[model samples]
Target: MNIEHLNVNGMELAVVSSDEIVIIDTQSALDLAMTVKYETNVANIVIDKNIICEDFFILSTGIAGEILQKFINYHVKVAVYGDYSHYTSKPLKDFIYEANHGKDFFFVATRDEAIQKLTETQ
Candidate 1:
């Protein structure tokens, strides 16, 4: 995994990139956030969606909700960026739409947009 730190509006953000899936479950998601916080002292993170397990996008599995809840509990804001147009589940689409309108979590198309979402004021 490669972690790049960026400062936007005086807020530190960690951009995590990895070739393999990093978050296979809720525990793994929390671990990633904790690792980022420990390494960079940043509460905000931007991760490539490809690094997350495909199960996370399946709303029926409840992985997305569980992982996001862990992030919220730990006060770790995360922005996941990638191409999500391939997902056809309406529930997943609605979940993404709702999350995008809120703080702490975001689903966006690019790294730059993820960074923008993370750095924005609450």
Candidate 2:
């Protein structure tokens, strides 16, 4: 995984890029809150949504929700990019739809779209 810091609204935003999965490994809510507070003007972030481990499946939804809550609490936008066609869970699909409707969260099919969404957020 590679992380690049970009200037957005005069704040540094971390852009994590990886062929496998994108992860934000903030130690705690306070850490994330600090990052968000400092990067308040940052509009969006792109995260890889691919699940690599079987054990992760159980926690993925909660993790996704937690991330979304953080974004919402901070008034930041986010885009999760990956192929979600393999997942046919109704609840998951519904969650995706709900997230897409919000200006803060987007579920994109391609990395290009994710980047576009994150960069274009105003």
Clashing pairs in 2: none
In angstroms, give how far residue 18 of model 1 lies from its true place.
Answer: 0.4
Per-residue C-alpha lDDT of model 1 across residues 48-118, encoded as one tens digit per residue = 99999999998889999999999999999999999999999999999999999988899999999999888
Top-TM-score structure, candidate number: 1
Model 1, residue 78: C-alpha shift (Å): 0.6
Q: Please state every model's RMSD to the true fold in angstroms.
A: 0.8, 4.6
lDDT tens digits by residue: candidate 2, 1-122 = 54455665554455445565324332343254355445543445565665222222334547556656766887666676778788767777888788787677788988667767666655
Q: Residue-pair clashes per candidate, as listed? A: 0, 0
Candidate 2 TM-score, C-alpha based: 0.63
Clashing pairs in 1: none
Number of clashes found in candidate 2: 0
Task: List ranges where model 2 is wrong by over 4 Å.
Answer: 5-14, 19-43, 51-61
- Judge candidate 2 against the unseen true structure and give its global Cα lDDT, from 0 to 1: 0.58
